[model samples]
Target: MKKKRILSLCMGLFFSTLLYSQMVGIKTNVVMDALRIINVGAEIGLSKKMTLDLYANYNPWEYKELQMMKMLALQPELRYWFCDRFNGHFVGAHIHGGVYQAAGIDMPFGIWPDLKDHRFKGHFYGMGVSYGYQWILSKRWNLEGNIGFGYARVKYEQFECKTCGDKVGEGHKNYVGPTKAALSLIYVF
Candidate 1:
């Protein structure tokens, strides 16, 4: 099946990268965790100053009958370290894709004015650029912070409330603003 093929390809890529990488880091974004979203990421050193990073996050719980923040997201980035891999400053280019179901939430910056009164289920895809800093905490741990800004093309179906299945509107939106933010704990090897 298609799912099996995708899983197999991902496993092969992961293992093959492990074989040749100079270093690998496993990380979790604490910001996402604080919001009850589960997230994990890996950074594979491709060269002395370059690395590939992959990150994924998911949330599936509803807080109340009409309050929810449920979604799955993935982002992959290529980074160039200013000093050395996992050391100091870095810049990256990344692509992101995700699906979300949200209701009764007040989004920051008034990005989605109707979210607090309506429910939305949608998928989005986009790209962005980021700047980040990583601080070595010890022999095998690090702290990292990053922020990115760019564009997302969102397509969604709107409903009156979280449990209301009656679709009211559906359309495409072009969004521009902050795309990523992370405060992460990383274990390096």
Candidate 2:
């Protein structure tokens, strides 16, 4: 019931934005694609220098019996273009939320040292600021690069391994680091 309401609200907002937007862009993050995570985004021009972007990604494949990465995430950002919407440099403020299940993966910088040996199922929410640049590739295509940093509040239950049912621990963690990265291919209409 709660999930449905959230989904409905997002859909409503997306449609309403589309109705008033002068330009709309559809995009896919190549970085996510390379990792076998499917992702898509839509940017709606709200003004000459402003736009709203909605992005979502999903990963559901298991690499092996003991290794897996399954997740779904959604992010929405409001951007201020230094030059014009969908062109040149921009800065944005964004909020993100997601649920994940991961195991048998080494986290960079030793942030989650136990992840390589344990499984974690969790949910997280965060907000951040980002800087990005977009280049016009053709009359209807563009390329974009963006990065963001911020904090996330994560809550998770730990299991001994990917297939283990015994819960070993559960806790909340506050993390601060890179929150968003994207190299996207976009088409404008």
lDDT of 1 at 21: 88
Error of 2 at 161 (Å): 2.0
Report model 1's TM-score to 2 decimal places.
Answer: 0.92
lDDT of 1: 0.90
Alpha-carbon lDDT, every model: 0.90, 0.92
lDDT of 1 by residue, 1-189 (tens): 753575466667777887888999999999998988988888999999999998888898898657888887778899999999999999999999878999998888888888898999989999999999999999999999999998999999999776776889999889988899999999999
Clashing residue pairs, backbone N/CA/C < 3 A, model 2:
none
- Give all TM-scores, in the order shown: 0.92, 0.94
lDDT of 2: 0.92
Misplaced by over 4 Å in model 1 are 1-12
* Candidate 2 TM-score, C-alpha based: 0.94
